[model samples]
Target: MTASNDIDALAAMLLVRELESALSAREDCGFQLLSSGQEAVAVGVAAALLAQDQLLCSGRSIAPALARGLDPGRVMAELIGRASGPCLGRGGRGHLSQPSAGFFGAHAVVAGNLSIAAGVALALQARLDRSIAVCLFGDGACGAGALHETMNIAALWQLPLLLVCDNNLYSVSTPRAAALAPQRLSDLAAPFGIKACTVDGMDVRSVRGAAVALTDHVRSGGGPAFLECVSRRFASHSTSARETRGQQELAADRELDPITRLEKALLLEGALSTQTALGLREQVRARVTAACAFAEASPLPVPDEAFADVG
Candidate 1:
């Protein structure tokens, strides 16, 4: 469940994890919704995506953007509000978009990108490109009206959109089970007759398999689909949010870290040797370092620059 028995998947997951870790250590790194524990969900879904497909995500954009093949250096720049970023750093964290790169961008609003994804899907359907739009949202957005309305239209029109809920169990400080009524979040899609399934978000292979199947269904004109990835959040909701979990609970959750899970399993199978694993880590660390250097050297936007992209 951790991988498709593929080292590439493992590598991608590590890259994001490390890149974020580097950012976390920086004093200037603004408040972030670090995808510390949800790397598997982003990497797994990205693995199944085609270059032409568009990916829209929530504010936790670092992992998704990196997973979708954006330049890590530029992503780092964007995260830190540098002029060298893909959106000229104006988009910042929650608004990093490089549509030409197939990353439609991330929305800071919980359910904000849901309808936007539907619109993108409709446009894709009109263009007859057969490419799809994948929207990665969190469990907190599950209660939004936009999701339901978008689902209804996506199902009715058979738009090539995939709704993936990166359900990390807790929405900020509140437990998902406490806020939502459905036994399974995927059940919300069932009423629309959309194909749906729930998988282990912490397992890269599981998420990849489910994403591939659902993306295929959308590609073949099977309309929209929904995938719920049940995962755990390692950190408090955000860098700015206070930790609400107890010490024992935090220790237990760390045991489920997706990266460690795959790394341990692969080591046991001899698919990955200690030397190779260490090498991969070093390689990714160098990449993150290089990215950091690039970001640090890049200049910030001039004050007037803010008026440039304005309507």
Candidate 2:
């Protein structure tokens, strides 16, 4: 990565981190699946996408939505149930979408978006635009049959799709090892002969590098590719969910915070100075504050709006 791009990556991660931080502090934040420890997976994957490519993700979507370049204000409004939101306040946080911006949207269901992404890939394939459909799901979705069908069809038909697993080591209170049958989640793709790789989700640069290469192959008609990012989740499953982890486990996970990891890497590489790092945090905080203001300024949707977009 160039020095500029490195810093940009760092900033993007911070943007996600700060935005979630701000939202978590809100009394009306709703049931949020904050990406407190896995910002790298979202930012890294998004860095490789072109304007024409489409991205779909699971409910843990704040990082991906912001990383995909959705306006912070619009995202904030959507999360806060305001009229000016991307979905006009209908989809809420669980289903924030802006297709024109290449973010196909977020689905709260596990493995729910996999087939949808494949369907989208099929459409894009028919268009012959060289554009691909990417799905960012969690390891929890790996156990579902939707993944199996998606992979089989993607490989058999050579669909332009990129399957990304943001594995944060746990599915709610259940550890992945206890639940998932695969020794390595990426191995699931191997049966279908799809190109797959596992990378450190704590490292944004690693994710970006893998995504770029895999996306290039997918766009070039090399069929589908799977990427597994082994990451950490600092918070509970959701804001309303209980933290089932022991204090020690939470502390250890905090040590692997992707934002701090990348910031330290940039500083050590002379790509970022301490002053600039502080400035970036302040800037990100201000932007998030402005997002909150935008959301607050917009009125909540009225009862009549429930039928506004309904056909």
Query: Best TM-score goes to which candidate?
Result: 2
Q: List the residue pairs that clash in candidate 2.
A: none
Q: Where does model 2 exceed 4 Å of error?
A: none
List TM-scores for all candidates, in order. 0.97, 0.98
**CA RMSD (A), model 2:** 0.9
Model 1 C-alpha lDDT per residue in residues 1-311, reported as the tens digit of each score: 33344688788889988998899899988888888889999999998889999999999898899999999999999999999999998988899899999999899999999999999999999988889999999999999999999999999999999999999888888999899999999999999999999999998888999999999999999999999999888878888999998999889878888988889989998889999999999999999999999999999999999689578
C-alpha lDDT of candidate 1 relative to the true structure: 0.92
Minimal lDDT window, size 10, model 2: 302-311
